[model samples]
Each structure stands twice: as C-alpha cells, then as structure tokens.
Target: MTAATTAAPVGHDTAPTGHDLAEVGRSPATLRTFLHGLPGVDQVGADQRAAMLATRSIKTTAKAWAIDLAIRMVDLTTLEGADTPGKVRALGAKARRPDPTDAGCPPVAAVCVYPAMVPVAAEALAGSGVHLASVATAFPAGQAPLDVKLADTRAAVAAGADEIDMVISRGAFLAGRYHEVYDEIVAVKQTCGDAHLKVILETGELASYDNVRRASWLAMLAGADFIKTSTGKVPVAATLPVTLIMLEAVRDFHAVTGRRIGVKPAGGIRTTKDAIRYLVLVNETAGDGWLTPDLFRFGASSLLNDLLMQRAKLATGAYSGPDYVTLD
Candidate 1:
C-alpha cells in the first residue's frame, strides 16, 4: 500500500519516520524509461558538459556561495567525528562570529554531527542559528535490522539533533524488495516526531538510472521530507547525473500531489564547480521552486575550506588560511 500523505516533520527536530516508500510496482525498465526523459539528462550534450566546466569562470563569490550552500548538508559520523571534529568545531565557532560588513559570511544550513556529538555541535553553534543534524538508521552501510535503525534515530533526536539524516536500504532496494525500503523510511519518519527526515539514496550503488528514479519516488511516497544522495561512504556519492535523476523525481512528485519535496545531493562533492553543477541541476531541472537552501541541499565533508578559500580570494584576490573560516 502507498503511504497516505502526511505533514512534514518539525522545524528542527531530529526524529526519524517509520513509514516506507510504498511500492509503485513499476518495472525497472519503465522507471528508467521515465527517468531518461528528464530534460536535464537528455539535453546534456558535450557542449553543456563543457559549459558546466566553464562555470569555473563564475565570480569566486558565486563559487563560494554555492559551495557554502552545499556544505550545510554534511553528514558526520561518531567514528569519523574525532578526526573531523576540529574542522567542524572550528566552522561552528566561526559561524558564531560573522563579519556583518562582509556579505560572504552567510551561515551553513546546519552542522551535521553524530547523535553523540549533537551537544558538541549545539554548543559550538550555540546561538548562531545554524541547525544541528545527525545520521541515524544504520548510517554508512545501513545493513542493520529495521528496529536497530529506528532506535538509532530516536536516540539521535533525544541527543539534541535538530534534523535526522538516514539512509534507505539500498541492499533491499537492489534486491527488488521496494516495500521493505519504503517501510524502513516510514518507520524512521514516524520516530523523528518533530525532526526533518533527509533520506539518503546511495545513488552510486543503485546501478541504473531507472533504479535511482524508482527508489527516489518510493522514498518520497514513503514519507521522506527530503530525498538525499550518497552517504559519503562510497567512492561515488553525489554526481550530477545521479542528482539530476533525483531532482526529476522531486519535480514529478510535486506535480502529482501539489506538494513540494526537498532534495539533498550529498557525498564526495568537493570543489566549487561540483557545487555549482548540482545547483544548476536543481535550478534548470526542478525549476526555480527548489533553488533556496530550504528546498535543496548538498552533502559534503570537505567543501567548506574550499568555499572559504574561494570566498577569501574573491574578496581579497588571495586565499586565506583554514583558520580564517574557523569551525566552532
């Protein structure tokens, strides 16, 4: 059965939902055929690819903002927390002291931390207005049982995470058990109570364009407040091609239900050019409705310093030290 439509999660709660993306029951080939038709994918000729690369010519300020907008969807794990903590903490701290005179100091949308480190991020970003997010539901691999994933989500929300980022069962998804994937996402969403649910698709492993589209729709139908790509665990996380498919899914869902869905293209997205391509995909494919950071996000682990350096260069014609954009 398809999930009945429901309300979105609270503004800043980190709870996960329990509903799954109901099976559309469409065949894989059908889904692929549907996906291949999206203009962003079909229209990308060599010229367009070259144009995307040429986007490097954009003002560094533009590059900086695009990178900044994306790094906000970062997914930090408890295991990786120790090594990456310095940068995250510094960024959180630096976020607290924005230079009002500098137009480039806009804050990241959120600082994604492990549930255990929510307090660390909360304290670091204290009063700076940036959100705190956590990845639950057997993050990275998501190879755990359903109950385990739900418990992880609830725990993260309790630990002070304002948003929850969870991965779908790509294992099940690939096995053709679409309902299982849907149910898992739904369960996490229900558990989130008030937190936003950003569903990760791990597009790299989905293997086919059709699988990506089918999985994307199933997730949104199952109750994903946001459809995200990659967990940053795999070599290939958020690529323009994968993101393009997800964006089309969001657009189609909106057309069908008059409900606007959110998209987060995450993982492995490093350079300023990567950020702009994702943004352009959202703008040109999903249309302007998804442009704001509210409707779209890009997950990244190393995008911040690049953004800061580029921003600094734009402002002073030279790069600055990592300390210049200190994490909290």
Candidate 2:
C-alpha cells in the first residue's frame, strides 16, 4: 500500500516540533509484553491480513449490522447548505427523522460533525434517541494552547454536543511533554460535563507500537471516555497494527483502573467487510461487552453506503443505490 493510503489522517500542518517515534523513548519490550497479553494482538501479523480478507466473504446481516458494525461516520461527511444554525438543525432533524421500518440500520451511534455543526446535530437528535458528537480543540491538528483546547471542549458541550473528539498536541506529545498531554486531556475531560471525551492519538504520526501504547495509557490516565485513532483527515489512519496496539492499551487500562474506555478506528474503512474485521477485533479482545455500539465504533465517510448496499443485498439478494435511502 502507498504511504498516502495508510498514513494517519488526523495530524496535518500542526506546528512541527521535530517529534517522531524515536524521540518518545517508547519501549519496544513494553509494547511487546502488552501485545502478547491481548487476545488478538497476535493477529497483527500475517493473520490480520488473512482475517481482513476472510471478512470479505462473510455476508452482512441486520443483526450484526446493528449490534456489531454501527458507528458514527465522520471526517468526510459534509453538510449541504450547513452555513447557518438553521441549516444544521434541519440536517439534524433529517437525521433524527428515520423510519422504524426503513431497512432499519441502527441510527449511527451518533452524528459527528464539525464544531460549527454540533448544535445542529444536538438539536436534531434531541428526543429522537440519537446522540450528538463534535470534533474540537484545533481538531486534526492539536497544535493549540492548553487553555484553548479546554475552551474548545467547553464550547462544544455548551453548544449541545454530547461527545467531544479532540486531537492531542502532537508537538507537545512528541517532545516528551507527557504531563502537558495528560493535563490537556484532564482539563478537556473536566469541561465535558455530561458529554463524553474521545482522545485521538493520531497514531500514524506516532510511528510505532510503543508510542501508541504510551499515548493510549496517558490519555486514559488523564480521563478519556474513549481512545480513537486518527481524524480521518491525515495520511496514515486506522490500521490493524496500530489498532492492535491501541486495543492492548484499552485492556491494560481496564485492568489498572477498572474503567472501559471505548475504541474507535477512523479514516480508511470504506466497506462493510472491513467494518466486520473491526467488530471481530472488539469481540475477541474486549469480549461481549465491547460488542455493543457503546464500546466499539468505526469512523468513516463512505462506509455507510457500503453498509447500506450490503444490508439491502442481504434482504433482497440484489444491489440497490446507496442514495436511494437519502436522509434528506
């Protein structure tokens, strides 16, 4: 695969601080020890490639779609005429307004939109049984000040988002500014109120399994409700090896703190089959509890269409247009 194909999409044009994986001093022995303990980390090798391919032949089922594969699709989804709060509200209303029998895929775990679109999703999903998620804190580029990041988190929640996804200050993080990274997450978590906080590590830039693990643990210690990989806007994102390392982090964090933070692999997933591999990872690593929509999610822009198409194929044994069920 091309470097562009697998590069993390989250960190882009942030202030370059001459940081890379080598600068972090992440211990390979530590990452290996952690990986060995995870149930499926071994699959990060040749087997992962085999498994990803295997999922291609597995048919999509409604039950699996709802229980295993549904997640908030983001990064690439753009709003039409969402220039004003009113337009956002209308889009939210449209998303909130779905039919009980309209092929019935689980309304995505939530609607993820730009910070400007948070209120629209919040207002639109309100009382409709869906949730609102927003990307904030100099998102995709975590190169802003700590207070600014905290303020961004606070702003998103104030505007009606129930969840906030923030990028870590890669510059600080790569400088071995662990305390800065820790404090930023803690502050953001504090500002969350009733909202959930998803900390994005932008793993591809981290460049190795060890840094990914360290970043994961640091975020969990600092108070993240979930740990996500990439913003789907960068070069490398959501790869199996990176995800394997992150999964180990979640498992280790759970053992240490008894808290289960969610895991979301965003960026490159564009097919239902790929989604299922992530499902299998969740099931095998975190067990049945992680199988629910609450703990596991896939972030994608074009993935929804593939899912819908596959779902329709299961029902009628024929293909259908993804736009045929337009939310508008």
Candidate 3:
C-alpha cells in the first residue's frame, strides 16, 4: 500500500463539516459521539508502513539537505528539574548557533523550557529569530485544577514566551470527560493570547492507537495550533507509528476545515537517521506543506548533535567525532 493509504476514512457518520465543527464540543455526548466515530487504526498496517518508510534512503546532496532541514525542525529543549539559568543560557546559545564553527549551519527552530525559565530563555534568545517556548499548565503530568493551569499559562506568556506548550488532562480524557479536557484547552488558548498553543496529548498514557487518534482530533477541535506526541517524561515517547497516526489526523482535519495544524513528536528522537525517517513520514503522509518548521518540529536536546556530526560527514567526507559537537 502507498504511504497515503494508512487508515480508512474517518467514519462517515461523524465526518466533520462546518456545522459539525461548530457543534463538536458543545456537550459531553456530542464530543463522545464524534471522537468514538473516528475510524479505528490498523495497528499492524501502521507498524509495517512505518518500517517500510524507514528503509527508504536519501544519499549525498539530498542527505545533506535532509540533515539541515531536520536541524531547523528541532526544538532544542532542556526540561530537567535540575535545570539552572546558566544551563538554559547555554541551551539558548546552542539554539542560536547549533554549530559555532560552521557559519552555514542553520539555527534550530525554537528553544523549549519550563515556565519559570521562560524569562531567562527570552533574554538569551533576544532578537535571534528563534522562538521561545515554555511548558506550562503543569506540564508532563497536567494534574492541576483549571484555574491553576490558566494561571500557569498566563505567567509564561507574560514572561515573554511566544509559544506555550500545555498538557491535556489525560485523567479526564480517559474517563470520557472530554468536555472537561476541551474546556481546559480552550481556557489555556485564551490565556495564551497572541502566543501559539501546542496541546500535548501525552499519547504514551492514552493506551491505544484509537485513543491516540481520538485525542488528536479532540485537541484540534478544542483549538490546538499543534498536537504534540509526548512530554519526554514518558517511557514510550515519539514512535514512528504514533507520529504517522497524528499526521493522518491533521491531514484529514485540514481537508475538512481548510486550516492547517502542526504536529510535534517530542522525545526519544536522538539520531540523524531517526529525524530523516520522520521527515520522510511527513512528506509522504501529510504532503510537502507540513515539511517546513512552521508545521513540523522535533522536541529534542541531543538530536541536534547527531545531525551536526552527520552534516559534517557529508561536507568533509569524514565523520566528526562526538568531541566536535557540544553535549546538551
């Protein structure tokens, strides 16, 4: 089967229209019907197709282009509890110039940090063209109350974060309290004001591919500018099969709404080959429109080092040792 042939059409009974879009989350019953009506994922097929695409290769000049493109798509992230201002500043510097010795190296797409560190990141990335993203709404776990989550988001934006990554309440979503989840996303987006809102589904805990699809559509319906895969704190962060499912969701959503939404696969993407596989997946599944940094991003810290080493290999015909690239 072709790359585009990943899943069946979203069930006809709930296929979204302008009116359907307007009515999506009006009530719990309405949200459940629409989400449950989405077509079931062909799990075996998804795994096989992702494996097939991974076998496809880019060589020489095309490989170089893919490496650079992947570099630009990376959200150079540092979200550790042990994180310090000095460490954040170092990450900001890396975001501005991924490879200090190479002038041709393109800067990363953004730098993501906790809400408290947003001000530090904002200062370090000042006027550098790289976006400042903060994880708020009680990131990773997302166990806070609605008012607390809103306050968390407000503080990040007020601190100069241009992008806010908020986590969905997985407990509510799992208990079929989708309206609660929807209301929370809407509230967070409102708090974001001009900043872009990326809704994290934390798919690892969602339990199944069908749940992943349902969560993806639910987040989009609630006004997520981007649907993110994981928070990098999960054991199953960012797999190719999961990312493919999200790509297909965004593809179908755009077909209905004529509005494009981005996809971000955070965590466990640490190699040049891994990044290229995701890029190819985007190209094949979502078409070229999603290939740019505006629509796709890899939330990673060490992935940049591998891409830079591979880029140097292509340019100099020799592998640059790990010593050449700074460790994040």
Off by over 4 Å in 3: 1-14
Q: How far is candidate 3 from the true structure (C-alpha RMSD, Å)?
A: 2.1
The residue-by-residue lDDT of candidate 3 on 1-328, one tens digit each, is: 1234344433333346767878878898998998887888888888887788788888888888889999999999999999999999999999999999999999999999999999999999999999999999999899988899999999999999999999999999999999999999999998999999999999999999999999999999999999999999989899999998899899889988998999999999999999999988888888888988999999999999999999998889899875999888
Which stretch of 10 consecutive residues in model 1 shows the poorest summed lDDT?
Answer: 9-18
User: How accurate locally, in lDDT, is each candidate?
Assistant: 0.67, 0.65, 0.91
Enumerate clash totals for all models, in the order shown: 34, 8, 0
Better of 1 and 3 by lDDT: 3
* Tens digit of per-residue lDDT, candidate 1, span 252-296: 677666678899877676766667666666666677678676788
User: Which lDDT tens digits does candidate 2 get at residues 41-79?
Assistant: 233453454355335333445444542245333222443
Leading candidate by TM-score? 3
lDDT of 3 at 58: 81
Which rank order by TM-score, best down to worst? 3, 1, 2
Better of 2 and 3 by lDDT: 3
